[model samples]
Target: MIYIYLYRLPPNSLPRMNKVILVTGANSGIGLALCERLLCQDRQIQLCLACRNMQRAEAARSALLVSHSDAQISILRLDVGSTQSVLKAAREVKQRYNRLDYLYLNAGIMPNPQVDFKALFKGLFSRNVIHMFATAEGLLTQQDRVNPDGLQEVFATNLFGHFLLVRELEPLLCQPGHTAQLIWTSSSNARRSAFSLDDIQHHKGVEPYSSSKYASDLLSLALNRHYNSQGVFSSVICPGLVMTNLTYGILPSFFWTLIMPVMWLIRVFTNTFTLTPYNGAEALSWLFLQKPESLDPLAKYHSLTSGFGNNYTQPRKMDMDEDMSEALYKQLLELESNVRKKIEEEEQDTRAHGQYLNQTE
Candidate 1:
């Protein structure tokens, strides 16, 4: 069911110099589609796929190679939900690349998703049916749990882990004489009411997915405020209502198939139904071709598709205040400090126990 169009260039083509880009969760869905589109745009850039599953990463790389055989593509093992993995991946990236041009923080999760069918059915007949389908507002919820890092799984995977990676890679991202782009794959479901400064992790909420996405939007603005002067610019984009693995989890595959015609009908009313991954990546690819200085920090660029299959990117103002964004940034810094100290203590204890066992033997 998947098709990859082969693109070939002149045999004497040389790779571009110093254009290293890293994309997390690059093995599938929008991440993989973005990779394909990027290579199709410029096959010479150095691209690294940071994925949790190496086997899948390899498969993705092979698929990309079918079209871009001579392109510079590499794989990296990364599990952004885990603090230790984020730290390790950052170190590996530092050792491998001197400067990073673009970082696509596209990895995210919505574990144990549940849809309120009553709400969905009622909304379908309401005036806000298009809006509900576009954003899934008030219709979806998720069951989140704590990861080994002692953080909410959705928060850790969607926002905090990427924050830590950015902090660790500041050296590469904020290099002199060059501007780096931090592009977050945020969502339209991100609502101001879902996120709270005190409960940033959404520990007590069923809609942790929404809260985490909203947090990412706020964090992007904060990053630009703090790091823009240092040659690092941050932006967020929404891929619209794409049918990725995450979407499949919401309903059965057979159910989605049955509703395919209805979805297409809805697309005529709402451009947010970018059902395919390629269409979903329109905004992401559009951003790649844009100047970092020209983007608005307060706007979220969205991928929109017309009923006639036309694709475009649109930037809409987000409902957030600068003061709250700054406050959230400060709290994240404090959390990072506490996490680091805890990790150090755990390591020391582990080493001591190992030494004791060796001595006893």
Candidate 2:
């Protein structure tokens, strides 16, 4: 059930020159936490909760309004995995908002995540245990499928759909004298080795989520090269190992609850275990306060927690180069064109079949 809540503010109700921010997957987890933090930081900004589930979106909006009675919040149905949904939501955004300030590409999926207990047991004794737990390298796998748009599920949801939205909204983002920022919620599990230009969709790979995040890192750099001159900046962030629904998928909540003490102990050695969603949203909330122009194109911002539980944002140079980023950008453009053409052909065929049926009748 897709529902578009029309709570558009009257002319006088609009905040004086307030920024309009859109967050995808703003219903729960890190996305929802980021929204709460943003509203707390600036009461005047207009927020649009673009989510796949309308009920959850409405609930999230209501909860936010409880603390922020004067804030302007709207909801739109957006399933980033679907081509039709992305197009419709982009249209809605352009229609409803005069300008877009920050576009958070935070909606993603790790469908049917299965953790390898065998590898987990071996990693427990290895010197690379910290890295293993941090990256989940060979320990996690997800079941992915093909979407209606004829792309791999994880690729379409995490990367391709967001790519299309940016392209579609380029008019609002890439202006002559204004600036807009694209912030992606990447993960510590993002690995360079998991991604392959040859198998960009990871149709035969096990770590599609990691592959998607790495692609996002490359795409952010490529976007800087392509659109930085047009006044649009892109950055990536890692929320560390947050125990959100995504993490709950890795290990059951009860099991995680039992191991909470162990995780807290391990947090001393590797602050990547930013266990709470609020702590996970630290970098995302920090990025909102930054001057987009001053950010590094190749650096990935991280949300880190200390042994004392202090939160801070840190920027680390990604293991990507300009050449590879450019290559990825070109490839994405090609795929975008191809996918559009394919969908057009399908629509035409459906129309032709309908016409033939009507003629016979």
Candidate 3:
């Protein structure tokens, strides 16, 4: 059985003109679903889809246009895994919009994921079955690689790139007298045990995806601490066990199809089995209409679906501390400085080489 959840804004709560919202990985899944929900609530808002592939981005735009024919939509080419691409996209955003109202950091990756079938089967008979299924704690692992930016691919794509994007667009996001929301598509798998302060990129860990997500949770708290006075608020959300392309990569489609009924049965025990993308995007769309000051910085909002097919958003306290979050923030700032210096040096070298070649010619 499929469940559909519909949301409508109060008549007085409709958005004003020139409210700009940008979403990374907006081409599909929860990100795309969030976009559609946002448009449904407020058609006057300017929505920008920042995706790595222009072709997929165009297709997504067309799909959205089919529903809201008069909605204003724009596309930006952004690969959050690549530093250059992120920097370039930030510049484009600055040129196009004077202020950004919401920045959805949703692009993420879990490369070469492998399911531990033995562990899964073992957990099925154990008392921790529901917890295991909800968080995928011991049942999944991934073979992570380093991106061209010399950072772990999972960390770069999931956490660091979004951090860099926030820093690049700080002027627009931190404007006085206006509040901007930084909503991250975090996960229930963001366990405190998975993350290490000594290795923020999870260089020596098998669960880079989990570590990166934990890092994001910490970073959101840190952002709230430092930027709340400047009107920038950061919040993270767990989309539950949504069967997106990322989830499909873990197990076969037929297997998930076969277990569809079982998943629904599991939902009675735990609301985390929000299997569809639209259901997973519940908390994301909910945050769009909230007052930032009323939200708890340390809480991780979750998308939940009841067995009776009711959808709602719940705020759960994350397993994190202010001190650790601040430390991670400082570390990220240092890393950002080093990355900028390295890029500047490389750019200088490239320019010098080009001039040398011109002289020789």
Candidate 4:
């Protein structure tokens, strides 16, 4: 269930003196690790955890407080897959903060993921073993379904929801003389062929996760083109191969248990096998401290862990074109209009149903 908060601040409460950083999916994995790293780096940040699960969000807040007792933190319920949820959360954000310094679009999912072990085993014998491990190219797929809003679940969660959030927060993010950043947790699996302009939702593809991530890269560029002059800069990052709940779903627990030794060995060749969430969050944490102008708008920052366990960030150019990115952006706007119309209609129907129930009672 979504968490709700009444707007109340104590007279003794202090205003935020440091950056206001908001992270979606902030309760676990890379998102949680990134939060911890941020607080460790600076105790003054006003951190907001935008999560669908309030219980987990509170648990994560308690954990962060344990590490830094005086760190500022708040919670908001946001399910990026739902239009009503996103709209509600956006409204609450405007009420909660005066400015949004950093927006981390870090929430995403890989549903019903399947790994092609036959190809995985075959790739182990090939010269591109390192490439296979780094990109998971042709090695993974996921089942996709329609959300309640009649949009592709993976697409809605990973890309479109954040797109709407940015649009809603424009007054805070795109104002003159005020700069804000949009940092996304894109993936190494994002491929050129995985995404299609005509099928932006990837409804016909098994790799909807990959398609959505690739779309994120394009959308970042589109955002830069449209909003940079307005002071909102957009960037994307790849957390490499982090072993999180998402990863656990890709293969069974026993399979991962059996491959622990092999994975560590493979880590020697490709540092993308960062494995641990903290190690995987290097680039995300790094970007938190950067000047937006210093980052490449078209590059996907990767978190890499060395064979000896040191973590670092690297930026690699993404395979994207401005023409395609702009086209995709326009399509997203059109889809946005359609969804908003549907949502308004749904709300009217919901109220009508409530009235009928009341009359019957």
Worst lDDT run of 10 residues, candidate 4, spans: 11-20
Per-residue lDDT tens digits for candidate 2, residues 1-361, read 9999988899988868788899999999999999999999999999999999999999999999999999999999999999889988999889997789999999999999998989988987888887887889989999899988789999999999999999999878877778999999998888999999889999989899999999999999999988889889999999998888878888877877887787788899887889888899999999999999999988999999998999999999899888888888888999999988988998999999999999999
For candidate 3, give the lDDT of residue 237. Answer: 97
The residue-by-residue lDDT of candidate 3 on 194-217, one tens digit each, is: 999999999998999999999999
Cα-based lDDT for every prediction = 0.94, 0.91, 0.93, 0.92
* lDDT measured at residue 100 in model 1 versus the true structure, 0 to 100: 95
Q: For every model shown, what is its TM-score relative to the native structure?
A: 0.94, 0.93, 0.94, 0.92
lDDT of 1: 0.94
For all the candidates, what are their Cα RMSDs to the real structure?
Answer: 8.1, 7.6, 8.4, 7.8
- Between candidates 1 and 2, which one is better according to TM-score? 1
Candidate 3 scores a C-alpha RMSD against the true structure in Å of: 8.4
Question: 95-192 in candidate 1: lDDT tens per residue?
Answer: 99999999999999989989998998899788898888778888999999999989999999999999999999999999889899999999989998
Evaluation by lDDT, superior candidate among 2 and 3: 3
Order of models, best lDDT first: 1, 3, 4, 2
Off by over 4 Å in 3: 1-15
Q: Model 3: what TM-score?
A: 0.94
Report the candidate with higher lDDT, 1 versus 4.
1
